[model samples]
Target: MQYKLITIEGNIGAGKTTLAKILSERLHGRLILESFEDNPFLPKFYKEPEKYSFPLELFFMAERFKQLQHSVNGPDLFHDTTISDYVFIKSLLFAKVTLAEDEYKLYKRLFHIINKQLPNPDILIYLHVPIQKLQKNIQTRDRSYEQSIPDEYLQKIQNTYLEYLKQSDQKVLFVEAENADFLTDSKHVDLILDALSKDYSPGKHYLQLS
Candidate 1:
């Protein structure tokens, strides 16, 4: 409640979108979900990461920047809070795992250029679920492209995300999600809200719902 903008991020199938939507509705905030459904390169990238990583990342970066620019800068007369399922940095994180060294360097430069122009979230909540749970969630979601995603790739992505969070200076609330399923339990959702309702400085914090 203290922050005007919050970002909920996690690995694929970690329930970020669902949590973001719930928060938006509960707080009467505007919700900005990442529009990746239309990305032509996504299915191909999943099928052939090495062949399509560069273009996929590039297209994603452009789209994320465009969406955030409009939504973050747009009017907020009707809402006091803005919540998004992703932060633009996600592009860079995924690129770190998917791109070659040279490609990552080029991508980093582009990321910074566009990133500085966007608003940073006041709080970043990262849901940390085990890879096994994440895999099950992915299958449950049943996106065809994602069906081919191997556990190794998911592990790599999880590592990259955790590494980024470990080094980031932004305010973050890392939630352990092995047992907490926000979609099914009201208590779990309340725990997340409790974390957000309190004050946190510019450092990493922890939340675990029992």
Candidate 2:
């Protein structure tokens, strides 16, 4: 792998973890998967977003900071390529959509403080899936908390991610992934692998594996 770190991100059920696992195994790279299941607030958040949004986001921000410090930011082999299913910025993106305006201001302040001390991904791969497809995937997964996630919420989060990524200075791969399936299709993995193997100028790069 050419990049030291690669991050795959998308809406709730966009298969970020699946692709991260595939690339990690194929390249023998270090993998950092998001532990969303372990969060105690997630279930309550979906059931009552207004009541739980702030704490849910706060919990995630802390967990992500600690996890990254333990894994990607560890005192390990500098040669090892690290792949993560989500980035630190994800906390902020989700917060923007879920938190109250005052709560979000505080969240962003905390986020920027933690973010500056962490390492940015060499490349951020955004798997672009439509809201309809995302909802289908969410339902197929059968997560009780995720079952009620409204399409409007997903759309807001998606828009937040796109806006931030578009203006970012880091290298980003915008994969039009409405039809891409890394788990079932080898070519889909190949397309991502190809992107990982080459270096790109810092900007948005588009791909459609068809």
Candidate 3:
């Protein structure tokens, strides 16, 4: 199948961005990356989650909505190929883990409204990695705001991703990132593109990294 829109989703340090960039270049698709650096509430929420979770989630929800809207309005609409580093649905996964009960309720209401207006991706690539690998990657990347991310938080995010994939009807491609070197391996990149080209059946689609 030829997907006009492709979304890459994963927990922090799962290498979604790297794959998205490579795929976009390989496939000649436009790339839409999540604006994590510009998110003012992210660092604050990471530091004091209880106090800042609601605002942070809301901000992300709004931004993601706008980004999707822009994607729909762009020339990519006619180009037949686009890749994004973050999927809009992943917003709720983070919210579920980060927000308090009341905050989550409110976030859900807003999320439904925003989600109803956004365009769904023709294909979603979910990257999975072990908590230890995620921790190691985060440390190596040295993103200051991410330095304090707890193992439990990464675990929750990973679990939430799996649950979301199980319940979702969208065409999904699950990739295990434990040993994939997407940045340097052409064969690995080709394997991913081939997986995306295939039918979206349930279950993991393992691609050997050369």
Candidate 4:
């Protein structure tokens, strides 16, 4: 099937943005990147997760909703393909992991409302890697705000992603980033394209690009 909207999802440092860029270029699709740098609450959340989790999640949720709205109404709406670095649901996953009980309740209520209003992706590609690998990637990238992220927190985020994908109704493509070099490998791109074009069963699946 040809995808009009494709979303790439993963924990921070899992390389969703990189793969989205590559896929957009290769597929000649318009790119919709998450504005992480523009998020004011992000740095504070990293510094004090318990104190700022709700605000950070809320900000991301709102931003993603706006992006989804634009993607559906913008010039790319009629285009055959479009790619986004982050999925809107990923905000809920993060909120579940980081927010306090009361905070999460409020967040969920708001999320449900926002979710009802946003457009859904035609295909969602979820990327997974070990916490150690994620930490290594984070260190290599050297984003100052991300340097304070704990391994335990990263693990929680990754677990939430797995659970969310497992229960999601959307057409999902799960890719293990344990050894995949999406930036350098043409075979990986081919595998993703093949998966997008084919009709496959839901649940967790892997594509070994050879």
Candidate 5:
């Protein structure tokens, strides 16, 4: 890989973490995973979105910033590459959907201040899975809080993610991953690796599983 830092991102249940973990191991790089499970407000946010959404997003913003700051700013040792499941901007993307207009304004201001200081990824890989596939994955994972998520809610988040990616300045490789099961098929991994190997400019580039 030409880049030292790579981030794999997607909407919920799009298998971003799985890909990041596999890539980190394959590349012998450092892995930085999100600690969403540690947030106390997550379960409540799912049960009562209006009541807990702000707190949930706030908690995630703080934690994500701290983790990225440490990982991105720290000295590199034996590992030459760093792979993360998320980008710090994810907080703003999710907040855009979850927060009310007034709340979103405040959140955006905070997000911009914190985001300017964080290190941007050299390569951003976005796994694009259709909503139906995402829902199936969520069901297969069987998380209690994720079980009741409505299609509308998931769609909103996915749309927000796509909108962000469209306007983002980072080198992006958008992969259409609806048909392939990467874990079971080594060929799928090879295909993604091939995409990542090529040099892309500072704009959105796309690759599809054939």
Candidate 6:
């Protein structure tokens, strides 16, 4: 109620997309899900990250920019609020983990330039699940490429995301999801709704299942 655009984000397999979908339906908001299944570099990147990391991230950044620019900037008469499963800054966070230092530096420059053209979320709910929980969820989803994702990689990504969350200037609900499942738990949904109903200064706000 206090936000015009709500973003659901987290490490891989944290169920952000499911949460975003549920919130969009409940709020009668426009849902913008990242369409990554078609990316040619994704599977290759997982198998050979050293060789494909740059291309993988580059393609993702381009696609995310194009998608968000179109979806967020367009007029939507039917829905007053917009719910997205990702925040644009995740691109930088992820690239920091996967790219070489020089590549990341260059990518960061491009990201800053492209990001200026997109609007930030009014509130971003970052679901923080343990690496083991995230691994289990990733396995359950059964994406062949993601099945082989090492725990070390997941840990790096989690660390990067946490660092960014701590320094973020935007309103963020830092939520722990190790004990909750947004798809099967009604309480989890209520928790998200309650978090979004209040206003907060631009900074991190901690949340949990309870």
Tell me which of candidates 2 and 4 scores higher on TM-score: 2
Give the true-structure RMSD of model 1. 0.9
Kindly indicate the candidate among 4 and 6 with the higher TM-score: 6
Off by over 4 Å in 3: 201-210
Global lDDT of model 2: 0.90
Tell me how many residue pairs clash in candidate 4: 0
RMSD over all Cα atoms, model 5: 0.9
Estimate, for each residue in 99-151, the C-alpha lDDT of model 2 and write its tens digit. 99999999998999889889989999999999999999999989887888888
User: How do all models score by TM-score?
Assistant: 0.97, 0.97, 0.93, 0.92, 0.97, 0.98
The candidate 1 region of ten consecutive residues with least summed lDDT is 177-186
Query: All models: lDDT?
Result: 0.92, 0.90, 0.83, 0.82, 0.90, 0.92
Scored by lDDT, model 3 comes in at 0.83
Worst 10-residue lDDT window for candidate 3 reads 201-210
Q: Count clashing residue pairs per candidate.
A: 0, 0, 0, 0, 0, 0
Model 6, position 116: C-alpha lDDT score: 98
> For model 1, how does the per-residue alpha-carbon lDDT over 78-152 read when each residue is reduced to its tens digit?
999999999999999999999999999999998998899998999999999989999999999999888878899
| Cα lDDT of model 3 by residue, 55-167, tens digit | 88888888888987888556644446889999888889999998888888888888888788778888788877889989998998998999999999999988998988888
So what's the TM-score on candidate 2? 0.97
Model 5 Cα lDDT, one tens digit per residue, 1-210: 788999999989999888888888888999999999999999999999999999999999999999999988999888989999998989999999999999999999999998988988999999898999999999999999899899999899989988988788889999998976878777877888888788888888888875
Error of 1 at 96 (Å): 0.7
Query: How many pairs of residues in model 1 come into backbone collision?
Result: 0
**Per-residue lDDT of model 4, residues 53-168, tens digit only:** 88788888888888778775577544468899987778888888988888889998988987887778887888888888889899999999999788899988888888777687
